[model samples]
Target: MSLRTLMLICALALPAWAHAAAPKPLYRDPVMDGAADVSIVFDKGRREWVMFYTNRRATQKDPDPADVAWVHATPIGMATSKDGLAWRYGGLAKFPAQCTGQTLWAPELYQEGGVYHMWLTVVPGVFHRWGEPGATARIVHLTSKDLKAWACGDTPDLGSDRVIDASVAKVGDRYRLWYKDERRGSRIVAVESPDLVHWRPLGDGPVVDMAAEGPKVFRFKDRWWMVADAWKGLIVLRSDDAKTWTLQESRLLEQPGRQPTDTAKGQHPDVVVNGGRAFLYYFVHQSNEPQAKADPYYGQRTVIQVAEIKEDGGVLSVDREAPVEQGLVAPK
Candidate 1:
């Protein structure tokens, strides 16, 4: 081969390695922007993608602090589409009765033994304004043997404090539940449950703790990836044994957005693998306000987005396309 030929080959390969190509956004939920905490469910039977999330009638830190208890949030909302690209809002799903105005948050729906199991943040006091000091936020899960009639079962007590945004993933035979509890600093903690209701603490209660919140997990390259948001930025940690994990980088990815409407402060890192490609769906809260002021991290409320997840062994960031999508969160 000629030296010139070799030089030409090197030049052609430069673009592929120059900077990893960003993944494409498949869908962005309008509700969380008005929509919050969106989850994506792929209906294999119908070959469709179902999007579910919380449609807040008002935010936690609304203009009126009293609205926190008064503004009745629309119950857990749902939308469906043939592809993840198009979504038609399906309105609210079943809300836990007796908990008025408690439009469910963190409605994570996953298939368990041919049934759909949903675990969500149930702030009962906010719904009723009971003013129950510690009984503010809780993680209550339910199961639907047929996706129709549901039954609430005994789950773990996230402490009466404020615990929300629960993400559960099945790693082989055991179940892993990740949630944010300021009860222990705004970090993600993991709990193990054999029956999916009762849980056992794995690794001193929190397997991964950061100055962040909203933890979700996805499996790729035959390994478990734990994604969480912290003051530093959005980080990804990998685990093979389910209990012990490794942080790929202190800062795995960062979303730069300057405006209140643009993608900033990425949270709720959700990933969807489709058509031999992977999409990372992250919730971007407009970072215009102090990070503390931002409910989830430091933005406006929370908006759902879809992004492409790059698989290059140890590094990945969101590839935002126009009208960018952060990725998939059946529990988003």
Candidate 2:
């Protein structure tokens, strides 16, 4: 072949390498800097991936000693990505004020029947401290046609007013929703629904008998996996039947990575399985960094990260230091 033709062929094959690796801190909320509890969904209409996260006011200054309002009265922030590697900050989601409250936390998204559904943790009003009188969190269901202009829907009664961080997955013919029940020692619990509206408790008690929050359940590598933020590290569990789960011996993202803004333990994971590959998107606080030492409030700042999940012999693991090579494949 001629040298000119050979060079043209090589350039054509370079498209894969043309896309950059996933950034160290995949994304950060431009406004608040407290992006947590990410829920990633593919926007079929827009042909991109959308990330919804908790936008905590981590930059708040001169707050009262007892005031926890920085974490409260937050909105669900949005970010969009064309290839799931490079993301841009989209504005906050718009939920009907009449249906939602001042405080919004973890948002879980599921799509069916050409409609998008979100299960959001809502606290009626901002509070001065945690567990203040009448301070309660509940999950509310909302539906949107275009991922904007959400309309209120039914609220599944999981028999708890102190529930948050919802994770939903379809198992068999029914949909299973897993969330943290703070009233039950912050243990992860679940409820099932044939449709998205009505719900019933899944089993006798907590699915994974551990004090964890931000439960994320998904099917990957021919097995059902559940990962939750256990404050120390992410607890991993595997199940043949999405109902009964076996806890893995090792935790993920437990130790700090050498990357910037990822020195602390990862929290609040959201998993996306595409084309037989799974990618984990989690948030990490900068609490252990020198910046936190200079400013006490710097510890409150958090950023989103992406890592490829690996499974071998029925065991799951993630190397946060490795570059993420898998880009999300558009839904068929």
Candidate 3:
């Protein structure tokens, strides 16, 4: 072939090379190998994506009781990525000594007033199974300037004995927090604060119906969106006033074509919106489902996944089976 024709052929093959070289659709914790209840925030100072999650011990098999082991004490897992998809485990978060070895649940990361704030669910008594009579859970506020070197604060009393999965968002001049009140049938409820220290209940009823947890709220476009883990799938709600909400008819996490067979429901979703593009981040347990049983690390182990959120005729949807690239891509 002539040199010019060869150059054209090479140019034609470039697209094929790019297509075949697309990054694999997977993200996992290399250290503990168990990542759940994931939350992501951009680190502008570090110029990368930082993920904080529940770092469960994947290799720790359940003892005779089975229930207690799964709920054992854990630290908040940390990972960093240049792009949001491929991750490198940065190790567990280093909190105050009091929080060491305590079961740290969903971590809600928010930045305000030049400080990085984290609302973490702290559960006492690791030996007791979840929902045990003596086990107590609370949400504590933490602050870090660099997402490292955290300062712990007292747990805010939300008029509940058992609360977990705290998510917060700032609207106008006030801050709003939504969390699961286990004292009230594990339903998701909301409270507001002007300074994020003292919170008052929004109303007498739960913001979301019973049987859901991990309430996350974010502002995208012109409306506010809230998502909760409903055990079966993710329950979605939208609000214009940030108080009254209407549930979306379709559940997000129960789509049938999930890879690795998401037998268990997707829990604790944190939505990251950038430049009018939204990406939903959540984790799925690697159960003994048909697609996961073949892997040696099945059961108890969980991996994080991200999906692009799209709106069609005012309805939002995600295809869990769609491949995610290594770097974050915002929709045009």
Global lDDT for candidate 1? 0.62
Name the regions of candidate 2 deviating beyond 4 angstroms. Answer: 1-9, 16-18, 63-66
Q: Global CA lDDT of candidate 2, please?
A: 0.90
Question: Residue-wise lDDT of candidate 1 within 1-332, one digit each (tens)?
Answer: 99999989988886332433223222334544446566677655555576777665533455544334432344676777654554666656764474323446767778755677777777653453433445556777777654445777665765536777788887778898888876786667778778787787766756665556667787777777877767456777888866687876645346555433444655656666655566666655555546535454223355565656776766665545444333232322
The TM-score of predicted model 1 comes to: 0.73
Error (Å) of candidate 3 at residue 239 is 0.5
Candidate scoring better on TM-score of 1 and 2: 2
> How well does each candidate superpose onto the true structure, as a TM-score?
0.73, 0.95, 0.87
Which ten-residue region of model 2 has the weakest summed lDDT? Answer: 60-69
lDDT of each: 0.62, 0.90, 0.77
Judging by TM-score against the true structure, name the best candidate.
2
Separate clash counts for every candidate: 27, 0, 0
Ranking by lDDT: 2, 3, 1
- Candidate 3 local lDDT, 233-258, one digit each (tens): 88888899788888999989774344
RMSD value for candidate 2: 1.8
